[model samples]
Target: MRPMMSPPLLSPSPCSLLRFLRLCHAPRRRNPTAAPPTPYTFRRRPLLLLPVAMSSSASITAPNSVVADPSALARKVAAIRAAGPSKLQVIADFDGTLTRYWYDGARGQSSHGLLRQGNEEYDAKREALYEHYHPIEICPDIPLPEKAKLMEEWWEKTHGLLIEGGLTYEAIKKSVSDAAIAFRDGVVELFEYLEERDIPVLVFSAGLADIIEEVFRQKLHRSFKNIKVVSNRMVFNEEGRLVAFKGKTIHVLNKNEHALDMAAPVHDSLGDPNGSIDDYSLVKKRTNVLLLGDHIGDLGMSDGLNYENRIAVGFLNANIEKSLKDYSKAFDIVYLNDAPMRGVVELVSELCP
Candidate 1:
């Protein structure tokens, strides 16, 4: 029974209109008194916006309505998801990161070990380092700095023996085929996923490059597009006989510098769109990193990068209980005696998916 309201008044001014329509026949210019066009609000529709952000220049927190706990890691995953595909990067060590750490309740094999020729000989010099420095490597009583020094000694001695023994291309190839190495479960999946997402995954290693590339190409079935390897490649003669290492030999302790120096250019090539990079530049920088390694010495594998959010996962093979605490403090995640990389694969998938 309410009385009808009177008709609303039509304003003479065009400024008050919700949406103003300009006629094709009308032409106006240089009206100094005219106001600017309505401010573009850029308002988001209810159905259009997605909440995926790792960090922002502007941040004002709101109370959570959903009870799902947002742990720091979960929030990181969310931010990466929002960042979508481009902002993520992975840096991993080859031997222990991708290759299995242990199998069938036995000490696992290294990638190089997979190429181990049945003629695995006992070199006195190499054996000496193994005997002397191997203890220091696993000595829980020793500090990391001390262990690092011993590791250098160990790696140097091992490489020195190879240099002295005149390791040949034929010998190395024969060794590789005879080796009993295998990839950790889900490693191929992890690599493929990164490739699928257009994320860069750099394998920085102290191992042999030719062997790793062979294994990757043969097993993973993807040419190294998403993958970049920085390692000690072999130098071959015109006839393809191995002469020596292509560059300065890579070792466990000195891997960081080599990794940065080698991978910097590749990162650069991937970072930009112009495609001018050629003849090998190693100066590309990345913002975010998911670093993986199996050795305690592997922590520095991805060092020297200007990284933003870095998540390091260490695969623990020997001395799990003792190494767990140290590895946990040193790495974001530690998989102790884990046969495969279920945890890492899961994390990457969640962050990137």
Candidate 2:
């Protein structure tokens, strides 16, 4: 068996590099109000870091990388590979998973965050809602049920604001034009590879379906026959004004395939009538899954299907210290510091080969 090469390293942002260099060179000045810095180390932790290279004949050799159970993971991979691409499907989270988490020293925007409602006041209110509920969304102390309920509330309120703000479809297009959003490196190649192999990929997001499709159309500039998007879709009026949202709300917790009943597939508008989220019975037969997501809750994306072999890849984009252990326990593989999708593409090549 050939050795698994390390994934490509991400280049540091120039602005961030300059800031770090200045801090290192400047004189040490103590501020009483500043909180003590959190200690971060890669050694001897239960969870490992990214670029974790593994070979069929060898165990995980990357010091910073972690696999919850190397032997078990290898077994799972072997099973899936034996089953081959015929039984494989990819389920991915849209926002931070497929898209870059950080870009140019700043956090990238989610599908929902790319909107500009044309009303400054309403936009401000939405930002305020994000500020309040985002912490609860990520708080490990909060019970899952409670957090889910809060997320439902936040989505409902935000959608209501969008309706009240007289949002237009034109605004949605303009938002995408103005937003600083980009897909992670290698995502396009992954999609292309899967498409070539006739493998179905379900992009399940709790974000706006229209926004996600726009990203594909405007940003990606190409559409795949095998990719389908399921999310909260907006119902537009004759004038293309946002009127209401279709189906039930899909919050962070209920974002799995189980919630497929609540939303319709977004691919029909792209001139394909075969793949509908409401009735994609064919996908259920593919009993091996490769799930990609940024949040630990994303593991549930496969809850609706009973897969004989499954691999869950988690992207630990932020608050690593607070969530790494839980992520390690939940996911088969966890990529740290918003690692690119090249590792995932490599994994697919291995599995589908």
Candidate 3:
């Protein structure tokens, strides 16, 4: 103050001064005996103290049929959905991925296995090959390189036996029709869905290509326009009897090496020297892949693709208990005990819809 003031009624200490200042600025408390104030006058609660309504019962729905990790699957599904169906491609193994592992409670036949039946000579050779190679193929402890060499030997011997058995085109047709080979549950629907969306399906198999085509033709009515069967094709003689296989053997291990070449378009009309037909260019643009397989080797199906995202679905139909961990490690999603493709179809629907 400009002038010295008279002594105060009481000389307050620093603590008392602080109290006086706080009392002057502080909000007034309601009288203990008085009724409570109206809603407008009531003090607001701190956000932290507010009661939040919590759900008593919560549920979580997974997208695919069986997934090793639900959160990872959700993130993958989200990425695929964001990309849409136009950018999506499906690479599936023909034998156990698209066809049922067992049909009518009996072990189903693969394209190669179809020939093993209905012929004594072929059956005997197949049994021998199985005795020698099947153990190696299924042995989890063995390294892949060693297993691959054994598989190549098995395929070469089996091919020679098939040729010696005089397997004709007519015989193949008959074998496919007679064998208990059937498409897996939801396979037809899966094809239909992919076809409707113009999504390409590459059936990459180590089995017989001719038989694979025949099966699709006879069973699914016809091979879809968007589907390409890439496998070991059988070469036939002028008389329509099996002469030899057309190209290098495609065993489980070497399937990925042929992916790029198989994806290349073979011009139907060499007459057009201008080479203007770019029919398959659209396929190259689809950089997201959905891979389905039963064996661990099937993971190589997408190896050569310039894919932005890949969702590997493993169908564990046999040795499930021992192989589940391995399948989960190798594949993003694993379906146990021959689970149908319904969940896969559902996931496709969400992505494409």
Candidate 4:
């Protein structure tokens, strides 16, 4: 059974999480030109720091930058084109957003999923955690406060299970390679565009670091130049043994603090009144964003951006019939069982003036 909530926890209820998530993913800050002149800076993000990285540059591997159709994405594209990758940033959720939610036309393994399947001991424990928490995770009817409590328990238990699995850094690498997670459609093109333009892409996920990198390495033909994965990373010692995870537990709901911690210095350095904006302001005068996510909780993926205009596209990978309305409401555009950024491809093409 899931444990009840205790004090000192973060994450909102399912509805609240959805509501705020819907609000947050839309890129809250607009009006980029109003800010005073400031130097644009870019920094290599440290694991502990958050939301501190932003940049502008694009280097395309393939010539597939612009998508077909000019009507649908025209306005957004114009905004992005005008904003010119400078005032824009990309923040993505890994498991379902960037990677395929399922595989072989079925649900694929996640970092946690693979961890559970790593050995026999994890099998029963995984089932228990799933039975106890997965239902609550998807139940929008539940209140945020109550859900937060459940999530805390779920994460704690899951972490314990992973630690108990007796995994080493080498094991993580092996698991990740064996899992062979595929990137969602258009994800490759998207990654390429961001890198070519030097626009920063922050991957904030509940997945592990090793797996995230593995997925990227497997998906992209070229190396990742402008991307940073802010998901949980394991600590390995000299002997390459896994010691512990780095930083506070980042459950699905507790991203704001993580966002702040990462973005604080950047936000402060840029002289933003609300604290800092890292080296490059994620949402600057040309502040526009193209956000992609999967879960209701994912809407907060870009909780730090002060966007002038943000276009969000969600991948409704499962239970679409039941949650379609809520998904549509939560995301500006919702793609049902579609690959990552497929809608984005269509959306980018349609961004007219």
Candidate 5:
């Protein structure tokens, strides 16, 4: 069970809060040719030596939670608060980070897992694949290069099975509707907050893009303009049946390389008059990022972006005792088990509100 919230932390000073509000309300400059400005750049700085207060509601008493360095965490919080939402970009993993790993003592289905349900034959084959590949995917003992090769092979075999099983767009919708797939607590609110503020959110996943879209459409009931999904998109035939996957496959480890193209729209919307596709320049202008994910590999989600401040919040949903150390190294702040996204929501609120 989740623990109760502690008392409220010391609020930001009125002056600092007002400054943040001004930044949030600052209008975007769309005229690129209006001024001859200096070239953009970003530098990583150590956390500030300022006094930091943990949000009363966000303070976790759970034994599984891990914050490797409280000073660094405070610095991230300060950096985010200082930059405000207008200058922020969020890149997140979909499967376990956004969705609950376990619900009501039963394992919840990921986008890919949802398609494997309700069919005995498919379930049997899926289980077999999991038994063969899942260990390699998660085994810390295996080297990443080897694991990457195995993961690609696993995805190839699974995609083949999905095609043989006659997976369709309609079938995906039905599966998501019938399966016990649910977003973690506070995810809906989090989406709403980002959407209302017009902050760009990219859901970068190795899961099926079609399934992810259906889940959002069916569950969230809105086509959020601010939220973009980049993953393995299924190519359908003339008759709307799954035929092949479009583009190069994006497995867990290679997400950073794939991110630039997937995040093009975000860069484009920043009003680059040259119509240039330089993701680096666009991202550098944004300068502050909030990254969220579930696995250690996910820490590379923002690999190419030049960001002034980045706060990686990781959800350690499985193997808590063993993985906490690694997760601590990968994420600035880590939440354990099935803990709701309250901490994330609170952090975002502090920046955007």
Candidate 6:
């Protein structure tokens, strides 16, 4: 943990910080239909500073990229640190955020991409869907609402394809076993730290919940009580076959805490107060947020909450030069070249120490 500076003079929370960061970042015409962006909400409170060592502060600086305003980033960090972990929650996008964008020499598979439904024709059809919609997903030209609708269409059609292909529970398990997906380096360390601290981590995703659970069971070897996943859930029949998805399709645009009620946590093995995603009473009280994601829209993952403070970290995995400016504007911190999660682990330490 790093040493904290003495509590700075307390001041009224700056509500316009979000607008200032966006406006000064890069000049762009605002979309009339798009929702305005949000920033870390600084709360006015009496705070106690913890005097700790400063050795690890250097580790928080990534060699890749960061938001242009270091002072703004510092202010958010200080506010969050002052509030401490008791008031904090971690909300992250699973694919490309928890998982790596690149592994070995090729692209890594997302929870959705790792599925194999056992029918060759169906597999081809699903790949076709990805080919068409993924481009639209990353395109900056489309309007936000229109893009959200397209994402819903993509997910709906893909789910229909899975059911049509006779997807079985056994098949999902096998697909996970055979998939090339892997977590980003240092992700386990971050999760372990959060688990030990009992800091709630909501793995919010636009992918399949079943596959994410399998990843935990097979890859991580255990489930953390402090963590819960909310994603598209598959309904399996008595014979253990996937019949349909349970609720409204969670697409990239709409993948936020708002979708928590539409689905259930896949790993409820904890079987206690913290096991279920449906019971978020504890989480609802933690208003300071630590948000992680790969897309510019991932910052919206905390949208459902009345957060008092939030530090958004974005992973710029691809199309670097093209999206870097916008990403820097939207996120408090941006890591490029698919950086490891070590920086985040260090960040959490500072906030919680």
Q: Report each candidate's C-alpha RMSD, comma-separated, in the order given.
A: 21.1, 11.4, 23.2, 16.2, 13.2, 11.1
- Number of backbone collisions per candidate, in order? 16, 4, 0, 35, 0, 0
Q: Which candidate number would show the highest TM-score if scored against the true structure?
A: 2
How do the predictions measure up, each by TM-score? Answer: 0.67, 0.82, 0.75, 0.68, 0.75, 0.80
Ranking by lDDT: 2, 6, 5, 3, 4, 1
| Residue 100 CA displacement from its true place in model 4, Å | 1.2
What is the per-residue lDDT of model 4 for residues 1-353, given as tens digits with 9 covering 90 to 100?
Answer: 12222233233235433432232233212112111212222243211111111223132111011112223333444445554556667667777677766566456777677653357777678678888898888787888778877887887777677677666666666666677366665677776656666666677777676656655554463455455566666666788656677777666765532443332122222233543223443333335667777777776665655556666666666665466567656666555443335445444433321
lDDT (tens digit, per residue) of candidate 1 on 1-353: 12123233233233312111111111212112112222112143322111211112133211101111223334444455555667677878887668754444354455444443223463555555666776776677887777767766666566555655555666655555555555776677787777677677768887777767666644555454566778767665775554565656576656763444444323232343433223323323445568888676776765665555566777666665465556656665554433355556666766665
TM-score of 4: 0.68
Q: Rank the candidates by TM-score, best first.
A: 2, 6, 5, 3, 4, 1
Which residue pairs show collisions in model 5?
Answer: none
What's the lDDT for all of these models?
A: 0.54, 0.75, 0.66, 0.54, 0.67, 0.73
Off by more than 4 A, model 3 = 1-65, 116-119, 260-278
Residue runs of model 1 more than 4 Å from their true location after superposition: 1-70, 112-125, 217-222, 239-241, 246-248, 257-285
What shift in Å separates residue 212 of candidate 2 from its native position after superposition?
A: 0.4
RMSD of 3: 23.2
Residues 32-60, candidate 5: write the lDDT tens digits: 11122121111322321111112233432
What's the CA error at residue 294 for candidate 4, in Å?
A: 0.7
Instruction: List the lowest-lDDT window of 10 residues for candidate 4.
Output: 59-68
Better of 2 and 3 by lDDT: 2
